[model samples]
Target: MATWGPEVVAGAAHLDRPVRWLHVAEAADVGVMLTGGEMVLTTGLLLAGDEQAQVAYVESMQRADVAAVLLGLGRAFRTTPAAMRRAAERCGVPLIVLHRPAPFSRLTEEVHARLVHGRFAALNLSDRIRSSLTTLNLSGAPLQQLLDEIAAFAGCPAVVANLAHRVLATAGDRNSLSELMRDWDRVSRQVAELVRNDPVTVGPDGWIVAALEARGQRWGQLVLFGHPGSEESGRMLGQRAAEALAMNRLLGDRDRGWEEHAAESLLSDLAAGAARPEHLLTRVRAAGLPVNRRTFVPVVVREPAGRAGDKGDRSDKAADKEGLPQLLDRILAEEAVAGLVGSIGADGTAVLLSVPHDQDADAALERVAVLTHERLAARGRRAVVGAGFGCTVLDEVRRSFVEAVHVADAALAGPAATAVARLRDVRLRGLVRLLRDEPELQAFIERELGPLLENAPLLAVLRTYLKSGRNKSLAAQVHHVSRPALYRRLESIQALLDVDLDDWEQLTSLYVALLAHEAQQAVGPEAAW
Candidate 1:
């Protein structure tokens, strides 16, 4: 951009060679710039006219690679020095003598304006390209799409790598570039060292390297293998592109956060039966959560009661869709029940879970409870908790949640134990044990209804319904109920047992066989179901 054209040369009387501008303010500094095509500019007050002084100036200029020598003619000398011009000519450098004082201030202004204009033009182009990329929402667009754009923009191959130098994405001459980056780990380390020297590198042989950075981290290096005309210009463009690409990745991450949240919520709902279990299971599988015949345990937690001085912060107890489920998954590991729903309740968390098969379900659940306590404790959280054994059916699971909640409440009220207690441990099974000790209690039930009393009315009805070959009217008449009422009662019994009565006739026969259980209890005391 400097005014180094022929017109500037024509103004000089004796300078016929081209002028390559090189500022030389120190006499000893010429050796640093010695690679040809340069014109040295200096005040020339250092010359004392001795032959040694003339030779020193001439030799220094020649060594420093100046194409010409420019001396201000307005200073002490009335005419151009004869020896200096001769010396410059002998060294194959033009001698430029300024007559009538050329205005350096004007020359500097022109040169600066041209340089600023060029930089501004390049910046404006970069901005336009950035705007276009932004409009396309390509910041985190697929890596392939970004690479294709980069390749197209550079008119050459482009590659994106991670900190480890693994090629994350590439475009244009992918085959060649991928092969080059196959040892990207080594290359990245080398590139990082190169970066300390300069972000921009132009080889003596026609190669350019534009260091790439994202989020202040050196992600990788970009090589532009071609002639270097405007090396700085290309570097500027590449920098803008790299920044845009980083921004794109940030935006993509932001959007993915929302998506992951939604997914967790949906899966949580399905696992809890708030939504259809089948539908949610499908979704879980799609999202990569396995749901096979895994044993599942459900846990219910009670949210903390707001104390008098407390400002409400139940938000932590809400199904966090994030931290809590992931924590549960980590604790459950392979034993985790399928279709697990982790929800934050008013005073707790409800987890519908699955686990692997085990002989002692109680022992298994106790271990999980211990792990759960440990996990929550590690996070400095203490919520009232309960867990239920894994169940195969949905109805059994729903009832189990209620039982688990009761056990959790009981556990919280008493001493804290690492083991999870089951509802059966505290309820039906406990009651059955107590009643099994007394024969008088059992005899009273057997005397109430004779054959039906021995089997119980519900059991007798179920047996009649099955023996009559699933005939509703015959079964209903024997049980002394209308047809519709019999169907309703059958439904009720199925609900009570938490099993499908219609699933098998053998179950019906077994119901009949168990009829004399109460009478048998009279013979030898045992618990009744």
Candidate 2:
């Protein structure tokens, strides 16, 4: 939108030869006028001094960017200096002198009108760009919407390419690009090489070729053919669009965080028995997670040693304390072992690890445990992990998880133990199964049998009877007590336990409780039932 085109010289008189448009200005400073690409316009008052100075001034104008000199002859010095005319001819600069009062007002009006037209053109282009961007945002569409809007504005076919130089989105006559995109399997090498080679302008087609790179990542290119717009302008707009798309992706990370939170909440409920694992699985599937028979690995995270001086309390803060369950979800999401892993336990203590197919599940569990531990460590906490044995069925997942927790608890009980133990490998398995957490039974035993066990003879007799499978003869033989003495010990034990010795279930319960107590006594306070 330059105001001074070559045709502006058409109206000016006293010009014998055709003068191409150069520039226009009235600055007294010749250097400023030249720098601004303006022709000099002034009366000959500059020639009022000596003739040599006049020749030097015209020579300076020749050396400078003054394309033409328009002198108003009616004002100031009324005549052109012969030295100035000789310098102009020598420098090949067009020189004209106006005798009558020149039409300065008309020339100013023309320049002003052209300047206004240029501003209007720029304003119009900006409005078009804003409208296109607004339409793209309003549609809430993907790449195609932006391309179509921009293409329509430029009156051309537009194409979006990915990092592989394959077209991701396209508008207008797409046959040229479609062949390359849809046939990517066949043309991947060619496309990769082509983009890497350089930006290529398709020949004779008026198409501009440019690359699409964002955030230091090369996303590919966008091409527009037969577009009636400046190539630089179009590239600038497209780059802005690319940046907006990347920003949208970044903004979506929050939504992903919320999803992880909801999934973790669901997992905690299932582990706590408030909800079933199947319920969580249902929701997972509904959310487009392909989880069918994922094995459950129940981990127990705890505080690390440095948290406080007291090492006895190894329990970490609750899983929900700092969105820990959600943290775990993000950690496991990118793992190869856990395709669609999530926590599904009460207290957010259990995780259901989904392994695609029957791969080496043990390795996967180890990886999951390592990652979980690392994450916990990073969070200024420590985790004690226990993975359940692999199960092919979902119904059995809950049971396996329960067993994993039990194993982990047992391992934690031993002061020397640092790692989780397999449920089958824990030496106290029998004792753990036998010990019941019924406070009523414990109270009855402590109240009634406390005095009997204090007496050595009565304790020996009771032990003999319990080990002999409730046989009186076997009790007497083992304890070296007479039949009558054995009868007396039986009566004492019956009174102590406050249960029928005749009933098999009661006798078995008492026997197991006694054995558990002995094991508990061996392990001390740390051995929990």
Candidate 3:
């Protein structure tokens, strides 16, 4: 007690240790009755004559991990004991001597009251955080919104990362978060492994980390980057945030992994135009995709047409295998490309690549395509990659995604020789695929190819003949027939459809009808008129 002219007799360097509580005891063996972090108060009357007992007392306090030992003068030796002081100094335990008589009861009451109040405040803050997070969870807020709330409470950056240490979501000041994410891959890997559930400061910048686990499995970590508050409060906030995230994951599609789910959610929303441009931009930025002044290229990759099967089977097999989305993520990371990749529907993987405005978008797209093909080839898998026109404006990216989907569909209808098939590569087939659902096109296909639809052999012959530029010998070779046999079949086809195969304009009409019919067939039987 400073009021009683207290003086630090030994271990003054450890005076700032946290005091969990104040204990007033006169017994030399009182250390055995106290737990750690208690500031023990005593008059030392029991150790007045026994030097060995005085040394034992200080040694016991050190063993019990007491914050400090307060020895009052006048009742014991009227001065600090040399044996006890030496023991305290040796043990490195703070030992304070009360030169004037100090009231142990009053000091204990005041310090205990403060400690209790502090604990109560901590509990209250904990409850506040829990209640707020619960409310947000109940309202079905997205993961990013929940992270934003955590960052606001922490007054610092908050990040959610998977077991692989890849950052999935982040919330904080825009500039600070951008800077932090610039080197996130390296910085995140440097974080020390968390052995305890409580938030512990780690890394060179002292990031507070908490594990996000559920059902006895830890999937990710919640990190408070550079929190500027007391460690106790930061731990409390981190724990609550981690709980919310785990709950959110559980309530979400538990079948999908967290990273995939995040990417799917963001990219799906952008593609569907379900979210505003500003909102989508905010989400992309928070998801660690570079958005500011970047060129956005929407790409879709899917299995070739002949390989596509039942939706459920494709989805299950893709889930089991190294799917396109995972492959794209790996390629992007290796190439140092900033992008968001995710599975779309059962047969296609969607990617939104972000390139710096100063970079060549075409070159970047080509690099990604080449890398994707090489990796897929290594796995004995092949996919058709379709890329849309790059856009510098964020809002136009959604249109690009739609264009990519159309290009992918068109590429599936024919043999795509290139690694990446763009709009021009798909040519007229792409346009017909995009407009295949129009009623006029459907009617036109039915009108032009109505009779051929019922004659499989004749339809095949006609298709071969038209595709071979009306060259009878080539068509005969393709159909495995002599020239005379092909001519007889062509005459039967001309008689049935009442059209001349030799007329260029009529042949052109027939070819367009064939293209539309194939596009409709690719869509399934329900699409036919």
**Best by the TM-score measure:** 3
Instruction: Identify the runs in model 2 with alpha carbons over 4 angstroms from their true place.
Output: 1-262, 274-281, 287-289, 292-323, 339-348, 374-381, 415-419, 429-435, 438-529
Give per-residue lDDT, candidate 3, residue 311: 36
Q: Per-residue lDDT of 358-449 in model 2, one digit per residue for the tens?
A: 57667766676677767665655664565566766656666665666555545444322434456655555433532434565566556545
- Candidate 2, pairs of clashing residues: 6-21, 23-39, 267-343, 267-344, 267-345, 268-345, 271-345, 271-346, 272-346
Worst 10 residues of 2 by lDDT: 1-10
How much lDDT does each candidate structure score?
0.53, 0.54, 0.80
**Candidates 1 and 3: which is better by lDDT?**
3
Error of 3 at 508 (Å): 29
Candidate 3: regions farther than 4 A off = 75-77, 193-206, 268-295, 299-339, 342-350, 354-529
Which pairs of residues collide in model 3?
A: none
TM-score of each: 0.33, 0.33, 0.60
Backbone collisions counted per model:
23, 9, 0
How many angstroms is residue 264 displaced in model 3 relative to the true structure, after the best TM-score fit? 3.2
TM-score of 3: 0.60
- TM-score of candidate 2 versus the correct structure, residues matched by position: 0.33
Candidate 2 vs candidate 3: which has greater TM-score? 3
Number of colliding residue pairs in model 2: 9
Give the per-residue lDDT digits (tens) of candidate 1, residues 1-529. 1232222322244455444344554364455656665555555666645556766677777776666666655464445666766676667556666655555556546655766687688778777767766665543465445646666666665555444444444456544454444444564565555544466665533344565565676655555534334655567656655666666566665434322433444433533446444333333333333345555466765433332222334575343324665666666675643434444443445565554454455565666667766666654555445666576544455445555655555444332344555564445332332343367545643443334433366766765775687798999888788998998877766655565766675354344333334324422212132
